[model samples]
Target: MAAVGYTSGDPRKVNDTGDTLTGGLVLSGGGSNLTVGGSGAVTGDLSVAGRLSAAGVALPTTFPGRRAPFRDPTRIVTHFQTGHGWATSGGVDAPTTNLNDTTDFAKGTQAAKVVFTGNGNLDISGLSSIDLTGKAIRFQVKVDDASKLSQLNIRVGTSTTNNFQWQTLASTATSKLYRSGEWTTVTVGWADVHGGAGTFSLDANRVPSATTGFTFIRFQVVATGGNCTVHFQSVEVIDNVSATFPNGVVSLVFDDSWDSQYALARPKMDQYSYRGTNYQIVERVGQAGRLTLPQLRTLQDQSGWEIAGHAYTTAIHDSRLTAFTARQVDDELRNLRAWLVANGFHGDSYAYPGGQFESTTDGASIEQIVSRYFSSGRTVLSGYGASTNVLSEQYPPPRPYRILALSGISDASGGQGLVSSLVAAGGELDTCKRLGSWLILTFHVLTTGSTGGDDGVITQANFNTLIDAINSYGIPVKTVADVMRYYT
Candidate 1:
């Protein structure tokens, strides 16, 4: 029943007394080969807990044609369980550290409650100086009433005055990540933060050196003429911020089949010898302000673009997967794919209408239904709002039926868009190149102005600027289908 003895000759030579190892056998302790005799059979079950190896070489957990688990390189900065030399400034009260705050905590039974007395920061320091190059700062925040707070910022530096900060409320992409009465995880990447007056130097010395290290990281909160309370947890530095693609791959996906995108953006795309994916709502084709059927054909037959599926209803909002009933959801997906195939488009890939759809809800029925008709389904948000380093699809996404994408592109203004600035977009490209991930940039409308001026609109000049940057990066700009084919 139980035979656990090892001989020296064969590394882990198990001396079995019974014909069958009843419970199970675990081969451990410096073994190069798991030699079940040449013609022997694995009668019952053999479980390798750590890893399986052969001929003194370890075998890969991930093989070709399958996605690999993310290499998580996470360094914990704090969990607010202990008084780790934390302090407050600018009239802010000191953190009320709680070791058993079950009612107000994000992770463990520990959380830090901070009341914003005025306009100031709650900071922690005395770190061992770790290099934060190509890393991101992630944390969870739960506010008593988020609407009461006018602004929130995550800052890092060698000192209070010498730091780089990202205003979460300054951008639309990041602003959505904040919601009161619930915990929100915020991720700020290395390239997203900017220096202020008398702060750290630019680029060369922006990130604290291994010697100098980071002195303190603070959450700066601004109230709308009153005080507010917030809880913090799980502050971490993530090194493997994104999954690696073979190389940086960019996919320009224009949703809704906007006539402006086809007319204004297509030519610019052609100028750069690039193609895009057009997620057309079936009912919108030939409708005023939308791409006509012929225009969609030209994009496919002439421009080398992928005309993918989007919606089937007369209006997109009516077809939103999140708002649909089970019957409606089934009808929408089935009808939408049928229309795409009938209209001579790639009906294989799908873009959820309004960037709506869930893979985990409803027993993953929506995802399963989508998978029935489409090879891949794309969504607008991947949950890491505005952090370019973490904004990309894994080479072979864990969920092919529900692929993740970054939405919105606009001129650097209120930081309302995903790629609000040239630097942000460049950061995304750099991340893709460094991590070998896929950067799928979503667009809606194209205009001719310095600023995008409205939601979902990127000015013509800015669109051109994006194209120039993509070209400069030397990354292959492929259509969604093409990228899927190459990777899959």
Candidate 2:
């Protein structure tokens, strides 16, 4: 039978076996499969239904497979104890043999063992050539009796006369402690070790210049109470970098049971699948112009919003709790908790009413009460200066409780303006993305009509726009409870 070439316009039929397609070929029929016997190029996206096989084919070396090599800018400049390049000073005695075979060594087979006798000290050097500029030094050590060792210090500088010293027993956030009979890692940042005087006089912000990089690095151990033996190993200089955030988080908190939030703002948030927190004053529930129990419960169950405790009465904010007696503050918190429990709410968080609190007088008492009841408590922008303000800074290390600083969306005179608020919100979001930090933005009322002079009311349109902006940034929105869980 002769092969027939149909030239009809019907796509069901291949017009000619020898014909070339100028534009492209489209296979639209159901369950139709096309096979290419030779190499082919797809300039656009190619959708595949079944498995793609390229066995025995010579593929391009740059073809996408695993991700390309990514070397983190933060890394170790030098590593020691792998071989010999060590020296010791003072009356201290160095280990006679390699201690790598012993289980006491943290890493590698070789370690520096210093024996402290009476009031004498040991100074270990030889890392003078390696650059310690803007880098932190870390080493592992095991002590026979940590109590007997009076002090352990590290000195780094361009020269002996230009040295800056840091004491390990200072108990700063970066300080490390040595445990008795067990290996403990000690990390000291260069910024923390700067003594602010000497020939080097390294500033906290300045790194060592190329020409005058640190030429001396020493570890000194002083035995005050008694003599002890210490094993040190795995000395390294590492760059200090901010911790990476797993997707960058933003937590939305609505203070006070403002009626506009339940009516105007929540629906817009629901449209985008975002959840916020409502810090409710139990006394305001079922009031004439505030969020009722039904509304709060609906937000909690349907909208996936968190309902946390505020204060019992509208007259007292968290900061003003200092004015009230200790008994009064305790009563209000207890009542708020009871009200939440009776109303079928499981709140594990609290927010300061006005972000004001007296830390000296009743602050400790209030914190103690909050700690006993809730997992976390939040406060408004307490610190005034930009440097001291928590919201303006990057997310700090995790703590059991955080005085979450907030940036108000309202104007300085206390009026809700979309343009300024959006600018402020975007800046906060950018900071969070840059530092991989957690940002908590506080919102109050969402209203179309103003409450006369109320500064907290945000229009629905502006609210939606703000939410869209946050969504465009690809930042994950979390509730107060979620943040507490993550940080704690």
Candidate 3:
């Protein structure tokens, strides 16, 4: 029989040698697959780094990195490992540029680096038409210091004078929040570049038309306070893999099980025949200021809402999943999901308690544990203002466990009044309609009066107006689970 005490990462080996073992065995290692042959039977748990095939059938294994859905091959722009025909110009100080900086990069040995002191752009011009239809621009960017940077814009067009622009720092409000020294992977779809600091709209320019594909791509930086060094790596356009909704798709997700959500928001949503997703904190079901068990069931059974899982513990804490051992995370997720299933609630979807999926706290393993219990995990807004996650998740989400949502709708940047919210929602809806992407709008508490205060609290009137506006757009409003099913 094979060794019984072997565990994952253990430097132990087991060779069958045509032996028919009767006892259970444990097989695990770094990128090693264990096979059972010659009437060998393993009745215990098996841990594997790669696939485990028995009888020519691949056994179910948790390959954390392979959870992403298959995607079409990506089109390359430049890897910056070799000579690239890019140049720089137009600045007060004439910013320095290098196409092959060996020191900083996301892939290969080198990357295109720029040292900016004023307004300038790094661009490659006079190129053959490269079709960008149904494609998105993705790259890894690292700013030495984002505080000194005023703005950074990504432009694509025939030239600098006529193109669609998207001010990365301005549009996402990352200028004030993303003050770090890490490489951030940014993905921008065609719809993302429609407005926001652009000279013209994508439809008016006929830029990505079949006759005239895009000819140039530029990275413009404005730095006035001080000099900032930025690195760009693995810049390319990839086939847009997100599902397209003809009229767009919206998922109204309410965080926490606040009583106000069941009492006030439910009624408003019910009036329009709308349903929502409630990411309930399992431990707070019957707590004060929270929804009771009966109310939650009503939302799911009678109102047709989805009661998803969130905050596995009784008290919601930051980094709850990441601040523990892998075994602990597994237990927490397993128990929470078990409670939901036993209580007759559909618990396939989840949301991070405080957007705690960070490398600093071993959040990757937490995600693996989360994926074990949930079909999808909705992340907090902008990685809770501390991460590099995007504002909205694309359909067929690159990472189902890291699904991004649009939140903080009451913030200054998002605009306050009902009119402002409506306008902002309309703009988001426009992008969805154009791209057939998904938008998950998250809210926390519902109040009867006042529209300004916390990002989590939205007045009932504004909430009603938001729902009415969504209905007016003629888009399909669905719960999170429903959207995931439709896309997957």
Candidate 4:
């Protein structure tokens, strides 16, 4: 008495959510069109293991979407692998990681620091809290069995003038974590910092003379030398919504700044090169912000990374996405996409800078048009995208969601894992759709000290742990562009 396959709906298609294939899963070859829609049903073992994808008549390199082929990259913005020895890959912004170097922090060779740079005043306007404690951005630093660290905490805001005049909403860094020396991970929770705590606050406020504000944050380490290595695993910033990996497959994309580098860590962004090229600091936004070539690499090397376009500030209004002009928005999208193609990127994902809440109220047609070009997108509704987000249900059109955190937003508070997401998703993994998936994470460096940055800029060590979690969950972490190709 084996279970029969679903007999309705087109499982492979991305319509307005409710339309779906109901039965008969298959593993046979060339069975894409074998969809048992609203009127068909399968009572046997349905298997479609070999089938030529949309690009061919025969099974191609792999089953369509089975392996989710990687997009060709135009460059490398930032990359690291604990298994690969934590060597720096593309572009350089902060201190570089060299697994080959005897100073490998993971191996306890030398000490490392997580630096954050930005335009002083952060915005942390709508979050619940900002405390970092057991919940800290973790990074794996391998010790050489002899490296010693006197300070396990952080030194933020030392790169700017405002220092640390921001408020502490809610944080866990009230104390610091000492490196145990065995793949030692340190946590600089929000409790460890305070308002006007400049010097090492990494809060980049506008200098007194600059119209914009201060412009940099450097996470430096107070270290005692030894000889080993530190393999950077991942950088996890929380509370962000983004279009990633498969959604907007591309050969090239541009990030527009080097501030994120400092946010990830001074060493984490060192000598960064992507697809085998180094990114240059293109420009600084006075106190407004800074743009870099490597930062641009995030757009270029999107084969693995996801890039989202944000409204040029001022896009969110009463939850009815509004801004300079539709033409302006269109221009931004076109420019961003063109840049990707120009650089050799093939991805087409879009992570709205503002969130799902920005769904245009009077411009439904305009939003729809944008949707046509991009595939399967989500505007944070009421679910945890990391685990609870899925492909089946229709999201609320008017945007019935709110973001407690975003990857790059500054947090004068505490956050970690899926706390906010879980709360938003209402703690239901069952609501997560397995097919028409959409994920988005947003970030803003200039807002951290005042407002709050998306918690996504996580510690390399914590990032790796998160990677393990995502992989363990069996949900493929895709670039937004790649996801769109299949959905569209």
Error of 1 at 406 (Å): 8.3
lDDT of 2 by residue, 132-219 (tens): 4334456567777877776676666654556766565511121114546766555554323424336655332223223125656666
Best by TM-score: 3
Reference-based TM-score of each model = 0.58, 0.49, 0.68, 0.31
TM-score of 2: 0.49
Clashing pairs in 3: 244-436, 245-436
Off by over 4 Å in 4: 1-258, 261-291, 311-321, 356-364, 376-464, 472-474, 486-488
Candidate 1 per-residue C-alpha lDDT over 194-251 given as tens digits, one digit per residue, 9 for 90 to 100: 4443445544323322212676787888866566777877677764233233445788
lDDT by residue (76-181, candidate 4, tens digit) is 2112333322212112224533333444343334433222121111111222223221121223343332233332222223243443321111111211122233
Q: Which one wins by lDDT: 2 or 3?
A: 3
Please, what are the lDDT tens digits per residue for candidate 3 over residues 351-406?
Answer: 87766553324434566667777788777644221122223555556567667677
Cα displacement (angstroms), candidate 3, residue 382, comes to 6.0
Report the poorest 10 consecutive residues by lDDT, candidate 4: 391-400
Evaluate model 3: give its lDDT. Answer: 0.65
- Write out the backbone clash pairs for model 1: 171-415, 172-416, 244-435, 244-436, 245-436, 245-437
Q: Could you tell me how far off, in angstroms, the CA of residue 223 lies in candidate 2 after the best superposition?
A: 35
TM-score of 4: 0.31
